[model samples]
Target: MKRLLEFLGFLAVLQGVMGLVHEFADWNVGVVGRIGFLDGYEVYASVALLALGGALFAVAESRRSA
Candidate 1:
């Protein structure tokens, strides 16, 4: 379960990053709506993913040391 969470976290982070880029990037030209709601969602997902990834990384590190 922990490993699975870690994997998910990584995916979330990726999604978030993509969202942020899309939201912030000046690629709003010639596009309808001017802003993608998905990008906003990505930002939220990224934060969650980062947190989970951090926890997983810590656990793995501790196990390796042990």
Candidate 2:
């Protein structure tokens, strides 16, 4: 539960950062740059992922350890 959420959150954050770096630096990194449908919306998606990761962290923090 908590661990799973934390892990997912970490992944999301990593991808989000990667996406943003890819966009700004044109480093050819992250999945956002590889997706054809997300051509013009990479930044938005990256930001969304970052938000989702934060929310997931918040939820994980509010949970009790089993």
Candidate 3:
């Protein structure tokens, strides 16, 4: 579970970064609309993803430290 959270957190961070870039440039390498089915809410969705990812990462860290 910890590993899964870590991986998901990492992926979400990466996707959020991509979404931010795509939001500005419209690059769209096929991941922009997929995250939370973001659609036109890319900016907000990306921010939310980043927040979720951060929380997940924190959980993973606690799990690891324990």
Candidate 4:
């Protein structure tokens, strides 16, 4: 469970960074740019993803390694 959370957190952080980079630099990277409904809200979504990733990491840290 700890490992799962850590992996998910890492993926979230990666995607968040990629989304931000894609939006700012127009690099055509990450899933944030491809979603149709998130046309104008990519930045906000990316930020949310970053927050979620942080939260996931925190939760993972608080858990016991079983």
Report RMSD (Å) for each prediction in the order shown.
6.4, 0.6, 2.6, 0.5
RMSD score of candidate 1 (Å): 6.4
Clashing pairs in 2: none
lDDT of each: 0.52, 0.94, 0.81, 0.96
My TM-score estimates for the predictions, one after another, are 0.43, 0.95, 0.78, 0.97
lDDT of 3 by residue, 21-64 (tens): 88888787437666665667988887877888899899998895
Residues 31-63, candidate 2: write the lDDT tens digits: 877989999999999999899999999999999
Native-to-model Cα distance after best TM-score fit, residue 32 in candidate 2, in Å: 1.3
Q: How many clashing pairs per prediction, in order?
A: 0, 0, 0, 0
Residue 63 error, candidate 2, Å: 0.7
Please report the TM-score between candidate 4 and the true structure.
0.97
User: On TM-score, who's better, 1 or 2?
Assistant: 2
Q: Which stretches of candidate 2 lie over 4 Å from their true place?
A: none
Ranking of all candidate structures by their TM-score, best first: 4, 2, 3, 1
By summed lDDT, the worst window of 10 consecutive residues in model 2 runs over 26-35
lDDT over C-alpha atoms for residue 3 of model 2: 98
